[model samples]
Structures are given as structure tokens and as C-alpha cells.
Target: MEYIQVLELFAGLGGLHIAVNNQKDANIQVVKSFEINVNAVKTYQENFGHDVVSNRNILSLSTEELFRQNVNAIFMSPPCQPFTRLGKKLDVNDDRCNAFHHVLKLLPRSPNIQYLLIENVYGFESSKMRDTMLEILQSCGFYTIEFLLSPTDFGVPNSRLRYYLLARKNKKFTFCKHDHTSIVKEFPYCTCRVKSLNDQASICSNCQREVNTNISSLVQQNAGNAAQNSLVNPGKLHSYLDKETDIEQYAVPDKILLRYGNILDLRTFQDSSSCCFTKGYTHLVEGSGSVLVCSRSVTIEEAYKVYNEFKDTDSEAALKSLRKLKIRYFTPKEVERIMCFPDNYTWPKDISDKTKYKLLGNSVNVHVVTLLVALLLHS
Candidate 1:
């Protein structure tokens, strides 16, 4: 049988691998993954039925060793911290950002590989590392197509925007240009604005009775809009409520809501696409910043909903089962969904929540990689 063989590097939670494996018509198979984080390795092993070589950094792995595996394609999502706007943006000099260099070095020694796919933050295009990687790929007889895309464009609820590069050996691929004017029309859900606690309290008087005055004042001060204070009394005490009620009735106050609005506002220029979800999401979920304070972090079930929205109906039952499994952070199954892994794949059972988060955060979204793979297959 003619099959597509893939070698995945930085394979956090096996998202790319899972997605490729799920494609009914695509003959893609992940032969191995190179990852250094033990937590991520555990999660990757759980879903893919492959043991990730943990604690062994990609830089230490030899090209000859990797070549022995008979890889037809190379898939990677290098560390974006060095190029992320949230980080120092150090580019090639960042010690943690060494994978790209190793990938370039290995390419020359592995000319048999027919395709290369890379995913990263948008800032990569402007970085020296990006230029160098592009140069190496071009020199190695790969035609490249680069684009900035978001899950929202394909109906995923989150605005996770990322940069994707698809290259094929000795073949040309056309780069798709994004039309800024068409975004709002194409993705109406991306325009969802932050809603304030006061606005929510007005609709749910039950919630207004629970909020304390001090917290309300702080929320007002931080969110920057206090005109809706009359909607609720300051001396009320907050009470624990069900998940749906909490989101609908007890959302952060107007003051904090303003900050979330600002965060969402900052994203307007980039169209409806969301900023990348990273290991940083844990911090964002736990923090008191405007983004965290005003808007709730997307839950695992919610993430499933987003993924399902973009997917075909045939996977609905599988998505529901995965969503109902209900573990904090994404479970190996949920992580598989994000990676686009098939329903029958098995995950490692003994992974930690921290590991799951780290691996999923580090993974490439499966749909994104599938598109790149499809381009290569056609090329």
C-alpha cells in the first residue's frame, strides 16, 4: 500500500499525528515523535500508543538516528515563546528555542523526506530564525506556502490564530491571501464582545444578591465602567453555583469586564482569530488580569464544542463521549480531538493534568496540519 509516513518533532500531545491518523482518505502514519518534556511525553504516549522518548531533547537526537525510521514527511511546531508577543521575542538566541536549528541541520542529511510542515506564532515571519529555516527548505528543493490562519475561520469557537508553512520537495504550492474585509462576514462568532457582571446581574437578580461590595468595587475599578453599579447592592455575598449559572449570572463585574473588552479589542486588528493558546493558558486561567478576570477560560467541553463545530457530523457521538469524560484541563481524548486523532486510538493512562496541559499547549492543531498535508499530497 502507498502510505504517507510522518516524523513529528516537539510532538506535544500528538495533535498533528492524531489529525492525520483520523483522515479516512489520507494514508498518513506517524512513525515516531521527538519530545523532551516528560509530562508531554506521557500524554503523547497515552493517545498515540507510542512511547515518546522523554527527557531526551531534540538537539541531542542524531539525524542518522531519525533517518533510520524511514520518514517521508517532517512535522514540527517549534517553541514559540521566543517569538511570541507575550514573551521577550528573542528569536534565535533564546536557549529554549533550539529546535528550528536542529530541524534545518537534519534536512540536509535526510533528502528522502518529501514534505515539511512547520507551525508557529505570527511573529516568526519577521524573525531571523524564520528566514534561516525558509532558506534551508528552499535550498533543499522544497516549495513553500505560508499563511496566517485561525480555527475560527473554519468554525472553531476559539480564536486560536497560528502561522502555518507547508513545503513539498521539488513542487510549487500557491500561498492563500487572507482578505481582511471578508473576516467578519465569514466568522460572525469571532465578534463576541466581553459581557460584564453588572450586565449579567441585571438579568439574574439571584447573582446580584451574592456579590460582595468590596469585590464589586474592585471589579468596577479594574473593569473601568461603573455606570451599572445601581443594578446590584455592594454588600451581597457570592455563593457557589452551577457551571452554566456561574457563566451566565456571576460573570466578572463591569470594571473587570472592561479589561477583557480591551484584550478582545487588541485582537480586532488581526481579524476574528484568537491569540495562540499556550502553556500560558494555565496562568491566564488562574490569574486576575482583565482577560482572566472578565472572561472565563474555555472549558474542556467548550473546547470540544468548538472543535465539533468545525468538524463533520460523523464524529458527533465521539465528540460527545470525549466531552462528557470531564477531567480538568483536556484529557488525552480531548487532546486527541484537538490534534485530530481518530476515535479508536488509545492514550497513556498515567498522565498528570500538568502534563496534559503542557503537551496540548505545545501541540499543533490537527486541522491546520491536515490542510498542510493535503497541500503536499496534491503537490
Candidate 2:
């Protein structure tokens, strides 16, 4: 049996590795993985093995060295901070971007590589780096297709809109519904399409609030002004959560709940959506992610009513009222589930929760990447 050899760059937590392993129809093997972060390298080794992943800096890899691997495909999620909206918007100028730039330099010379996939924050589509990348790939006789997709497009409840570029040497993308020039929101002819709660109605039962406008704007800009028609049913949050667990440690602090509780996105077990969880998840307040209301007994509607009643009148009393809902942060394991990591994926026991959150936040959505991997190989 011939196996597809893949090289993973910026392979933090091995998201692409997991995706390759999930392919049942294709014999895909990740021959090598490169990541610079030591802690991430440790976690990758824990789940995968020491032989596959390397902590060697990507910029140091020579074209000859990459060629020696004889990989047919490449998967990469480059340093997103340089391209994220909240960052300096350095594009190709940021020091952190040097590694990806180096890879662009290597690609033209490394003829063994045929299929290539690159993932980054949504802002990357408009960057100079993207322009340079396309130029290089085109020079190498590769046909490329771009996408700005979210996990929701693949039936996962999490909304992590990312930019993806898929290129294959000498072969054009043949998706029947899409042209190569346009960035797509959903996979062609995907069967799991369902309307996003925000698209159809509000995320809350009583609130008329819309989805985060920042994310909505991103979707509009990258998807060529087409409104998101592809959505997911989300099924239930319960599927991603533990059946039962002690809740004391996971409870939101009273001070935090009182100060920013009204603004925090609240999700219930029965509901099907969540905000994107970032590296600042537990440490930051707004834009981090949604907090889970652990109990179905205290309806989210009722919780809002309590906030309105005493929110301005008595701060301490509002804290007491909100506390009744048993609101808490999602466990790291739950975040992994939301990110669509396999049940067998594990972290080193010595890794702190903070480190776990950071690594997972920096990682890719496994389900989304898995489908992309399969599509690229089969194409």
C-alpha cells in the first residue's frame, strides 16, 4: 500500500497529525512535524511520539533538509499573532513571521511537495504575505483555492473563523460550486448544513442580541459579501461535556461575575453554539469565549432577569443572584471536545491548565482540518 507522506509545519499540539490519522480511506502518514515551542513539543510527543515531532525552529530548516523527508503534502498553521486583528498587523514584517517566510522560500526548491495547506487567522487573506505566498505557489505550477471557514461549517459548535489556502501542483481545484479565485465559506455539497442560531434568531431565548459583529464582519469581508448560507444544527452542548463532575473549582469568581457577568456570553447545555475560545480564555473577560451555565434548572432567561433586577441597585446582591446559575468556565477537556480532538488525545499530566489553554487556543480545529485533509488527498 502506498502512503501519502505529509510534513507538518508549526505543528503545535499536532492538529494536522490527528486529522491525518482520522482519514479512513487514505493511507496518510505525517512523516515529520516541526514546532518551536518546547511545551507544545512535549505535549505533541506525549500524544504522538518523540520520533515524529521536532522542536527545531522552522527558519533553520534548509530546503535540502526538507527535501530529504520526501513528503508529498504539507500542512501548516503559521504564527497567527502577526496576522490577527488584535496584534500589530505586521503582515510579513513581524519577527514571528520569519518562519513562514522561510517556508515560502523553501517551497519552490522542494519539488517533492505537491499538495500544500496553510491555515492562519482571518486577517491573513489580505496581507502581503498572502500575496507573496500565491506568487511563489503559482511560480511552482500549483493551482490554489482559498477559504475562510469556521468550525460551524463542519457541524462543530465552536466559531473559529480561519483562512485556509489549498494548493496542488499542476492540478486545478475542481469543486463544482466554487471558482478558484473566490474564498469559500462552506465545503462544496456538504450535507451537514444547518442555520446558525445567530443567522436565524438570537443566541439567547429572550435576548435579541446578534452574533459578535467582529466575526460577522470577518465573514462578509473574506467570503466576498455573500451572507453565510451554510450553518450547522450544533446538535447539543451536552455531547461535548462531561456527564457529571464536581463544579466547585470551575465556578466563575464572584468578583468577575459581578463586574462583567452581564457581558459574558452564556451558553447552556441544551443550546448548540459558543464563541471562539482564545489563548486568553480564563484570564481575559470579554471576547475570550462563552461561559457555561451548569444547571438547566436556572434558565438563562431567568438569569438575565436577575441581572436586570439588581444589576445597578445592589452589586453584591447581583453577584448573589447570578451565582445561583452555577455558571463556570468550560474545562480544558471540554474545550478539546469543542475543538473536535479525538477522545484519545491527552496532555501531559504535568502541564498546567494555563499552558493547556494556551496550546489548545493556538491549535487548529481537528474536524475542520480532517475534512480538508481528506479532500486534498482524494482530489
Candidate 3:
């Protein structure tokens, strides 16, 4: 009945908090969470209790004060904009990185914290800040493991490739068979098996060839390829979708569909993969995420073919053809499901859809982090 007390920083919508609290095998509690964005704090408070998250800037918090809370672990998904490809690669010089840099300065002073998990964009591993963090962690007597992983590597249908660094104070990772310095692409363990749609008793043939069935080997390479890694068996989008009464509100406007319809990443009812959903999910079309075709009757290829035919034709004909596909943005609820937030996760009634998308976009994938937390806390 021992509980592991956790402290979460940059706690956006409590993604890392949810991941920590949901570990069934471990009795854990998120003692405190720090977030600066008011909308994010409001969303976190709505889903978790009101007392959980504090609207405090991490740079302002004293390590001595934080350590006094006696938290055994710290989990953070610092702002990735500074390291993301879409932003200026400012690295440590980015003013946004100041808070994370402050935390690094505090780490050496907090001797009570045993476990640390940091989540960031793919580019973070190569950053100067990463180098500095590693130098500090090594000086503090911690064994560290880094990963470049995606939700698709697990059972989630979306591809959100992220960098994670796990550090244990004076202890090696329970599953660290590979070099700690090397970035592991797949989960260190594999218990997922996608059952054959055709044969209930057999694993899918594609998975059979690509995924290693052996767990002791600690390898699950290329499990992120949703189309090819049928072994990982990321289920289709239908399971995550909501039964909306007024679906048109979420549909791509006629103007957008006519202008960007051909470029839209469209997924049919049966498709297992989707692009990374950004804060610009509903607003930006090309790379934000995939738009779902509402009809089960229409295949993705069919929708694409129609768009192809209309690509060069008159605008009126293009508009008519696109509407038939019934393509729409994924609802916020659907986005939450794919992000691996639990069924009970909620937002305040006052939060607009745009704010919801923005907060969720800034969050982490719960299922992926949950598994990583479990491994980090293994004693």
C-alpha cells in the first residue's frame, strides 16, 4: 500500500499526471502540478480536482521548497515549441526554455527525487540543453535512458514521434538491456498482439514477420508504422469517434474543402493510421492531422479519386464532389480518445473548441507515458 508521490511540471491538461495516476500496479499520487497557461490550468482542474494544479511558473519555484513536498518523482513535458521543427530552433537560448533550464539548475539541489521523466519533441535529444541535462544527471549519480518513440509504436493509431528521457537516481532501469546512450525506438517490452481479422486464433501475418514475439529480446522495431506494423495492431479511428447529432459543425467548410481537399490527409472508417494532430488541427489542414470521411460506405481511395478528378475542374463541380465524401475534422472528444485520455476526462463548459484543441495539442499521449512510467518506477 505504499504510494509514490509525484510532482508534475508544465502539466498541460494533466497528460503526464493521468499517466502517473493510472498505473494500476503502482499506488501513485500526483502531489502537485505546475502550469502557467490559464486555459490549460482550467482544463486540468476540470478533469482532475481543482486543488491539483497551480498556475505557477516553474522558473519562480525554489527547488528547496519543491523538495520539501517530499515528492519521490518528477514528470515534465516542457514546451516543445522551442525544439520543434515548426519553430525557431533556439535551443537553450529560447526564452521559452528558461523555465526548463531553471528546473535543471534545481535538480542537483533536490536529493530526495529519485525518478525523473522528460518529454519533448524529436529534436531535443540533439540539443545543447540535453547535453547539459545529461552532464548534470551524470554528476548527480543517475542512470539514464533516452527514447525516440511514437504512439503508433504502441496500439494508438496516431503517429506522434517524441523524445523521452528517463533517469533513475543511483539505479539502472529494470529493462535497460541496451546502451543507455542509444535512443531506443520501440518499447523495451512487447505484450501487444494484433489478432488476425480473418483468423481469430492467429496473429496477423504482417506482424508475424515484422514484430518480434519474444519479450526477453527487448526489441520491437518499426512498431510505429500503422499500415505495416499490423503486429502492433493500432485499431481503426471508428473506436475513438463520437456519435455526434450535429456533425456538420465539425465538417470542413465548403471553401476549405474546395481549396485544400486534394491535399487533406483523409482516413476512411477502416484506416488504422493518422497524421500528428497539432494545436492547429481544425484550423490548419495540410499537416495538422487527418480529416475523417463520415461515411463507412465510402473508401478513402474513392474519396481521393473524386478529389483527383475535381482537382483541375470548375469550383462548383469540385464543391459538389467533395460534399459527398462528408469529410470533417475529428471532434475534441475523438482527439482525447486517440490521445489515450481515459473515458472520464472532461473539459469545462466555458472552454471553446479552439482552446480545447490548443490544450490537447500541447499535451502528451497518456498510454505511451503510462507504460514508460511503469518501467521507470519498477523496483
Best of the candidates, lDDT: 2
Q: Roughly what TM-score does model 3 have, to 2 decimal places?
A: 0.88
For candidate 2, report its TM-score.
Answer: 0.87
Q: Distance (Å) between predicted and true CA of 2, model 2?
A: 5.9
Cα RMSD (Å) per model?
18.4, 8.4, 5.1
Which sequence of candidate numbers ranks them by TM-score, best first? 3, 2, 1
Please give, for residues 266-345, the per-residue lDDT of candidate 3 as tens digits: 88667787888899888888778888887766565665677777767767776777788888888888888888887688
- Among residues 3 or more apart in sequence or in different chains, the pairs in candidate 2 whose N, CA or C atoms overlap within 3 Å are 194-231
Instruction: Assess the local accuracy of residue 213 in candidate 2 as a C-alpha lDDT between 0 and 100.
Output: 29
How displaced is residue 88 in candidate 2, in Å? Answer: 2.0
Alpha-carbon shift of residue 370 in model 2 (angstroms): 0.6
Across 42-113, the per-residue lDDT of candidate 1 in tens digits comes to: 656666555533546788767777678887888888888899877899889998677679778788878878
> What order do you get sorting by lDDT, best first?
2, 3, 1
TM-score result, candidate 1: 0.61
